[model samples]
Target: MEIRWLEAFVVVAEELHFGRAAQRLHVAQSPLSQTIRRLEASIGADLFERNTRSVSLTPAGRALLPKAYRVIQDLALATDAARTASGAVHGTVRIGFSGAFNHLTLPVLARSIRRELPEIDLQLVSRVRTGDGVAKLRNGTLDLAFVGLPLVADDIDSRLIARTRLGAVVPIDHPLADAPSLVARQLADDDFLSMPVDGSSAMTEALLRCCIAAGFRPRITQEVTDPYIMLTLVAAGLGVTIAAEDLASIMPRGARWIPLDDAPLFMLHGIGWMADEQSSALRAVLRLSEAILPTPPD
Candidate 1:
């Protein structure tokens, strides 16, 4: 019936003792009991089982506890946003990005968010996979995500912000390194260095499709997930791998990245946020991102 009632019910459910729950709520035990009784009556269900030796939630109470906790948490976040001093917007905006190519957007985003939204704190996570970003975004832990394309979740708005072309990473001394570019079939005979076949990075799919179009499945020799590590393996001559072209800037050592010349393969990149996001802090970050990283033409 009231926030206080839900609070009392939740505490009592947790403590499973009238005296303890009352003490935690800073109220007399009788009032706390009455509050739970009133809530149970309003819902027409027995919320708790009590006896001389023990107390515990009934099925209804157990079911309501998590929903009640979420209601309280959502209210607290809304209150904090509404009551922030001087109204400059104070809160942490968590952003998730997968793959080394994210190096392209994250630095500029961090600087922009700090300069533009001084009261907001930036929490950046190197989410190594798209599934990681999806899970965090849906759970409300991440406010924004730099996700690779082909995301199909209904609740996420995967707004295309940039595009990275698929390219091959090979030892600089490898024969293919001297060419401006080569067809996918040229590397068909060579062992491929790639992210694990797990569906984490979009490049994994793009590279596979490119090779398939070239009439062969890539002979994967290494299945490292991190882009930097895959490139390192490439440099060591373990095998050639597929990755975004921009990621070449991240590794200063032995790899020469060359794009597929005959059939260009590209990975579309985007920023993802919960489709219903209304947080001011999140909106500000999105605005800043749009200004700095507008999706390239077409």
Candidate 2:
């Protein structure tokens, strides 16, 4: 089938609604529907199940989604490679990073890449969470990513870059903020803010375990995805949070980071990429990253 057919199919699978998908593709709804029908005919299976109320992917469509993402991204990478071969730029590398704790590593890596590999065009995507970054790597969208660790994907390879102990962030005026460190039980009654349990990072899981092990289930008042926002909420006295100790460096004016000494939970960070990645520019970045990024203390 034509690439446009695959493109249309992917968009429809994502949106599930024909009208929204057509709007995204800037095409007439009728033609978009026709394209989906043509793709289904070529594949000999229905990709979507639709009715008056809603649209949903069929089993076949669900199976095709990841493959379609990889195919599209790979083709784009190939086009970039071909352009570079024709003297466009030496190569282009797309790097995804979660900015929550990489405030130091990301900037250092970017500057090093620019200075040492001047011919390579570096594209940095920021604030990408660990789960999203891993998906992008698997689908060939990101050449490299800084991810939260304990990553267990066979198709991906990663190296541990940093690890920091998990701690609590509380309002500056809170009663416990003056403590040098605290055990989990000390804050059991406090209203907590946390990352959503579903698809949460390893750090969040550890935080929950820490609280439970301390003999009280945490009263999580809010679930958040961004560390900065979590800290902001803490500063606003909405709730306290458990986050990597490194976040203390960027804690907002009204927030105070207190070390959680009990159980000594830690958050691991790593740089990850697809196992079969072959881009020379990406490999170069990997090499430079190994030399520059910090590793957990031995």
Best-fitting candidate, measured by TM-score? Answer: 2
The ten-residue window of minimal lDDT in model 2 covers 83-92
lDDT per model vs. reference: 0.80, 0.83
Cα lDDT tens digits, model 1, 1-298, are 8988887887887789999988988999998888988999999999999899999888988898878877865875786578565567877788887657688788888888999898888888784477778877765557788878879899888778877777777788888888888787888889998876887767788789888988999998778767777888888888887777788677648888887885567788888888885477787788888898887897
Give me the overall lDDT of model 2: 0.83
Q: Over the stretch 230-271, how does candidate 2's per-residue lDDT look in tens digits?
A: 789999999887888888899998999988778677778888
lDDT of 1 at 225: 65
**Collision pairs in model 2:** none
Q: RMSD for each model, in Å, please? A: 7.9, 3.6
Q: What is the lDDT of residue 118 in candidate 1?
A: 88
Error of 1 at 74 (Å): 1.3
